[model samples]
Target: MGQQSDGDAAVGSSTEFQIRQSFQNKEEVVLSVKDYSIRQGIEYRVLESDHLKYHRKCKEFDKGCSWLIRISLHARKGTWEVRRYNGPHTCLATSISSDHRQLDYYVICARIYSLVRADAAVTIKVLQEATEANYGFRPSYKKVWMEKQKAIAQIYENWEESYAELPRWMLGVQSTMAGTVTVLKTSPIHLGDQVDESTVYFHRLFWTFLPCIEAFRHCKPLVSIDDTHLYGKYGGTLLLAIVQDGNSNILPIAFALVERENAESWSFFLSNL
Candidate 1:
């Protein structure tokens, strides 16, 4: 109703009306630089490739320098920069992911820009030329570092104070041996201090010969049993033994001291056996 119809004048009016009714138009979509940058980050400008800065690939070489640069740059991941990596510059689609085997690179590397511009100090470290070469941030980087800190805190608590029970005299020794055992291990001491072996055999046995019999039970036999002396309070050596194949090893089973290791002691030993 409002405008002229030049196309309709050329075509029959009826044909023009039919064409207009039947035709459906398609829309065009164009994503501008600003839109991409906003979605990605300020560093997107530095990360994107420019033909002038990057030369074309060469057939002579299996790979190019740009390819190497692209491969080295890793991605950023995790909560902190702990495990994350912001790699150097490069060409090609060599971006990184949590798993490096998977090279899932973004067409427009928005994430790379987001991480690079985050801290200004990085700008000075990664010059403009290098920043553009490597694109895309690596993921899963930040999560691994936090776990190690937790382990060290649990394993190294106070070590010196835990062993305080040892007495100053012993220094490092933990247990005590009394009576004759103490005399053998240390030196002479006071009267009431404790008479080691003397108390057991002297006071307990009333100074009888019974204690010698007790010592014989623990003694290992010399096997080269000897009886050079015939008399003394106690004498004669016995064999030492251990059970083997249901028979005793030719070692001592016990000791039999005598008034003198004489025929009398041998008689007593045979009688006991």
Candidate 2:
């Protein structure tokens, strides 16, 4: 699809010209994918996704879940992202091509990232060529989303050994324009639950701190300053932080683990995370 001079009426025009009916609901997409997976007997998992992410603003919303197709077909860019939103629930796919030129580029890259399964291994060379052919557009920016994904997997495979099974490593993928963005957050069900120190460390590194940094990755890291007290256990409130990386998916490069969470422990973590 090419760019329309004005974006506001693009959807209406597309429907009038090409689409015969309203876009499918997110639930429908999920059901379709799920049904297909079931029929194929593909071992898979649903990813958290947002109803708002997969489809255009339909003036309404529905529930759904994103999926990782256990079997990946050979695809070029825009192979998946341009498709309907499918989900585990609340997993938001990034919109590519707000402008027509970039649309092809984003559509393919985003789709590629979305399909990555932790259990599968792929080569970077193959992924790169596929993106180029699929999108049919040479990206204006130098982008390598798969490389980022590989880096994240390495971090997880390496660090996860330390944590027997406290926090679970879900999935990591790159987003449009932004490359691969890792999604790792806490699923703590109880207050006094035992967790892995490395998981805790990585949790802070990938999910917590990077938001503000990523917002400004195009710019230099924008640093802010503040002060607080140490109250509980540390004579006062000790400085606690959550870190995430925006420039890349929320995966850690390396870490040093411990038995439990503590001030002295976290203090050392703050230095690296």
The model with the greatest lDDT is 2
The 0-to-1 C-alpha lDDT of every candidate, in the order given, reads: 0.25, 0.34
Worst 10 residues of 2 by lDDT: 8-17
Tens-digit lDDT track of model 1 for 102-182: 111221122233333343233322422232343232323232122111211122211232212212323322133221111
TM-score of each: 0.14, 0.24
Q: What is the C-alpha RMSD of each candidate to the true structure, in Å?
A: 32.5, 20.2
- Best-matching candidate per TM-score: 2
- lDDT for model 1 comes to 0.25
Residue-wise C-alpha lDDT for candidate 2, range 31-149, written one tens digit per residue:
33433332222223333456333322211123333332221211333122333323232333332332222233323333344333332344445555554454333333334443334
